[model samples]
Target: MSPATCVFYGCRHPVERGMSKCSHHRNRAPCSALQCHNQAYARGRCVRHGARKKCPIPGCTSYRRASGLCLGHTATHSAQAKARHLNLPPSTQPNTTPPAATEAVDAEWVLGLEPMDFKLPPSPSWNALDSVDLAIIHILLQDTVA
Candidate 1:
């Protein structure tokens, strides 16, 4: 018997089942991998085959970018976000006074108190004596006494 016919004109290949038409006749679907969608520099899309280059920023997807940002506001917005996260004063914050020299303003002060280190404190053993001591402390305290 002859092999199955290609849906595409002038082609003679077996069409895969469940697909509407043969590969040649069908439109090429773009790669679904995130690799095809560039995330760096805000470029969340492949240049040629990708769509949905919408900016990942909340509520803002005006234009597509080779990078996610449409070139005009990427760096500016990113730096501003970083500053916000680090508790540093926003660069975009409008000042009533004339801008001060960068060095004159204390960066640490602007950023606020230093973040607490993440180290865990030493774990104390919870034994019978600790429980007994806690019970005694509870018992000694009267309800009315401050």
Candidate 2:
């Protein structure tokens, strides 16, 4: 007997062992948030709405870390907090030193210093070719000559 297929439109996958719908189309309790179709994780809401721990920094919507700050803000805040605890004066001056310029070397100078010798291996003679190889060569030569 043929395997029972899912009834969902356009789906050809076999149904679960006893269920009417395929795994993909199986009935599930959706997220509590309106208009969302994702499966619920906790409190009848999806991960994004129910379990996500957002960064506490105002205006930042990034996910929170163990320190309760996003990756970028965590380092900045930690450094600043440490500096304040150490009683270090706040830096006010901007970096004024210009980056060092790199000089371009001429490719011709290197090529002139050492001339490269490229010698190709000698090609096999026509006598060393098989019948099939000779036939292909003959066809190519005929095309070129024409």
Candidate 3:
């Protein structure tokens, strides 16, 4: 049986028996598994063929993502490193709940919107949140209040 053709457009090159793309089109490393035609996911072999390098520490199934340990270990390691470098123990989590409104109104209030012909709100705001974001926030506030 003939090997599959290259997946690239306008290319008629014949792909090798254990390769997906032709030599000209292939960019990533081929799977280390014998006769496997898939791309390498990590640690040499294809994803399905045990590509992830297991953590050196036992009882851990997660593969090594960053540093010498697996992903789960990396998070705690990062926390430890941060605390050690800063010379401070990890602080309590910051306040997350929004402040409750102090005043309670007897009557229901309605929010009204003025029509914009199709333009972003006035600018000169922070670069991260553009004028368009202000327009959207206005709409969202109107929705929640109503």
Leading candidate by TM-score: 2
In model 1, pairs of residues that clash are 42-67, 42-68, 43-67, 43-68
Which candidate comes out best when scored by lDDT? Answer: 2
Model 1 over residues 33-132: C-alpha lDDT tens digits?
Answer: 4444222122333344344465676677566576667544565564565556656665554333322333243344346556444433334545566888
Q: What TM-scores do the predictions have?
A: 0.24, 0.36, 0.36
When summed lDDT is taken over every stretch of 10 residues in candidate 3, the lowest stretch is 103-112
Each model's Cα RMSD = 21.5, 20.1, 17.4
lDDT of 1: 0.50
Alpha-carbon shift of residue 77 in model 2 (angstroms): 1.1
lDDT of 2 by residue, 1-146 (tens): 98888664345779898887688878745577877655666677778676567788899988888888888787677556545644667784222232123433333332444433543333443457799998999999999776
Local accuracy by lDDT, each model? 0.50, 0.64, 0.62
After superposition, the stretches of candidate 2 with alpha carbons farther than 4 Å from their true spots are 1-29, 33-39, 48-50, 92-146
Model 1: how far is 74 from its true place, Å? Answer: 0.8
Candidate 3 per-residue C-alpha lDDT over 1-146 given as tens digits, one digit per residue, 9 for 90 to 100: 96688754345789866886788767767677777766677887777789868887779887777688876677566556545644664474222232134433212111123433443334343458788998999999999776
Winner by TM-score between candidate 2 and candidate 1: 2
Error of 1 at 40 (Å): 23
